[model samples]
Target: MELMGSMSVVEELREHYVAVVGSEPEYHEMRTRSGESVGVFEWPKGTSRMGVHLYASAGATRHGPGAREHAVELFLGVNTGSDAVKEGFANLILSVLKSNTVPQHGVFVAGNWKVIKGRKFTGWVLTERPDDLIPKLQLADGRHVVFLDALPVFPEEASYRRGNRSDELFEIWEESGLKSWDLDRDLPSVIERRSILRWPSWAQRNG
Candidate 1:
């Protein structure tokens, strides 16, 4: 979606918050879910570009917290195809929630399949805080869908860690000084330190 459309969604949600809560609630651009920095937005500035992490959170939240209450949860499949579609859908859902008013309480958005012996589903729900709500978004039949009752958690720092393969790649690249200074035998450690700089814009959106 376009930037204007995303801003409109944020504006609509802000209006809904004011209408229901009887006051203008604060709007924050969460940089990292578990970090202390959630960038607050001043209305009229317009919505910032949506990133991949925020997009994923939106999808996870769809089924976890958006669809349920106290014990909100979300489910996802353990495959690549589902992951790609779900990621796109999450972005769409975030766009929708930005414009639409959430129902009084809980809601749900289902997915193609469930993992973890059905203990977790592909979608998410919305509820209270301190509880990591799963928010999810998906696209189906040309329609964008979100599955969370409340806003999805966006973080200010790295939430999920990279895999060993990624680490190895970083180590090799750092030793070559392609992206940073050479630190002798500290190459490995330096690589680990500098790896954080490689996170995509979408991944670091909240910060």
Candidate 2:
């Protein structure tokens, strides 16, 4: 599962992609203060149908001291086309990685799926697995689960109440002067809870 070679493989992949699609590609790296790495590549005008954003990052386990060397993530985003762009990008990724298989490990694909919703933002999901796998997918309301990862942290009821109170206090503070120190001091505990919850799970857990 280890990516044995240098970044040359990635660069080669980008070159081949640009030749086929006929557009310039851009790359960005995301690094943590501790030097953990994340890689991102964007195709501003790679194809007439869509622009692509590809992301990769190392995976870390809870019990490990640092990131798992071989574990990585590959995510793609295709914007500026019909709804088919999402599925198209997903299939392209599968095609590229299928020939370069990684033994004894799993690959996961996830992102925001575009759908017909009344609001500006809509949620959709898709998944495809090898035939030998157990077909881990959810088919409720045109959504499917593709990968198994950590469980999500759901917000509690108290958190919502505090958010509402905080909004009211902020509104009053904006309209009033600094003399409203009593209102600031009387802010609900939910505000602090909400602030803490905004941090990454690792920070919350390690804190």
Candidate 3:
């Protein structure tokens, strides 16, 4: 075992996750009773249950040569929540995203199902395809994944560890220390409000 107890829950998750993505993890593919594929994933244990993320696409050209776009992310361990909060901790951040911090970043992220297999990246909702298109999702321990994901969307973006520390958004996430809500608010009400979901143009295009 990697002695996960010594590391913060978030750090532990990020480390294991990166390893899983690199190594030959325990892969799985789920199918319907009628023999249709539903979803798939590596099913690494101790998957992240709560997280914080900030993304601002200031555009690619705006950057000078040899520059990279920056994104900031944070995570909460499985035990990071309290009695009333628990897994719902992800929602607290959503409730506060627009009304307060990152005010213009109004769209709170929520995924209907995870693209656990075949797809290089996960999608909140499956891209429009034929009914026969293989279904994709992330399920583990007889459970399904449906929550606010706090990780940066791409490997190119910044996590608290490797990101630009001086960036204001990154600093906000770091200065919060652990979970942002912990330093200020106890926790906010669980809000399941609708957020505008964006999908790539290719998702809507014909093959």
Candidate 4:
């Protein structure tokens, strides 16, 4: 329960976000199925081309080994601007909060259905934004806020990653040469079926 003057942690984070990512984002306050409000900020095509969850980290605390003392915010990058994409990403982030689980970097979380319309993607591989696309922020209370890029993947890809090391799955993704950042890419599954022999090529490449 950290507050800065009269601004709460969420408000402070929002200010910090606008400072870093620019102040032109189309901000939306969405109501999840559970009736909880989550703030989303969307930057259109000319800008960051992403939608980020702002309030997800406020008040909620994470536990367990390797988990941060503070909570986390989630962001999803898009090749184009779409409200559907923003809402979908917001719902997913809210669901993670509802489940009481902290999304670790490079970890994969799968769902039974599609992530957004007109895409086969069904899950997320949470990781930090590369090349300082979005830098991690620290609150005045000394709590470092983490931002995770929720990279969407197909159901088979999700299943494959769950059975393998996070890095190994990452290798597969790198080898496949798909644009992992573009949620709206009209592409087939990088992986079709889960297999025990999935890493032979990865091993050879590393060996």
**Per-residue accuracy of model 3 over 1-207 as CA lDDT, tens digit each:** 210111232233334444533433232222222232211122222342223111111110111233223211222222232322221222223222222222112122323222112122222111112231122222222221112223212111112123322243333444545343232322122212232223322121101
Lowest summed-lDDT stretch of 10 residues in model 3? 53-62
| By lDDT: ranked, best first | 4, 2, 1, 3
lDDT of 4 by residue, 1-207 (tens): 111112365577667667766655665766654456556666665564234322223322333334455667776665664656666676565556556765667777665666665566666778775665667777776667678767777666677565556676677777768676665454345546532221111111110
Error of 4 at 63 (Å): 13
TM-score of each: 0.22, 0.31, 0.21, 0.73
Candidate 1 lDDT over residue span 1-207, tens digit each: 221223433454345334433344334344322231221222121221211122222122122213322211122212122233333333334433333444322333223232112122232223232232323222222223332322221111012122313234334544655421111122233333312222222222221
Report the alpha-carbon TM-score of model 2 versus the true structure.
0.31
> Which pairs, if any, clash in model 2?
none
Answer with 2 or 3, whichever has the higher TM-score. Answer: 2
The lDDT, on a scale of 0 to 1, for candidate 1 is 0.28
Clashing residue pairs, candidate 4?
Answer: none
Off by over 4 Å in 1: 2-4, 30-147, 150-207
Compare candidates 2 and 4 on lDDT and give the better one: 4
Question: Which residues of candidate 2, in runs, are more than 4 Å off?
Answer: 1-5, 45-73, 78-198, 201-207
- Reference-based lDDT, each prediction: 0.28, 0.29, 0.24, 0.57
| Candidate 2 local distance difference test against the native | 0.29
C-alpha lDDT of residue 168 in model 4: 66
The candidate that achieves the highest TM-score relative to the unseen native structure: 4
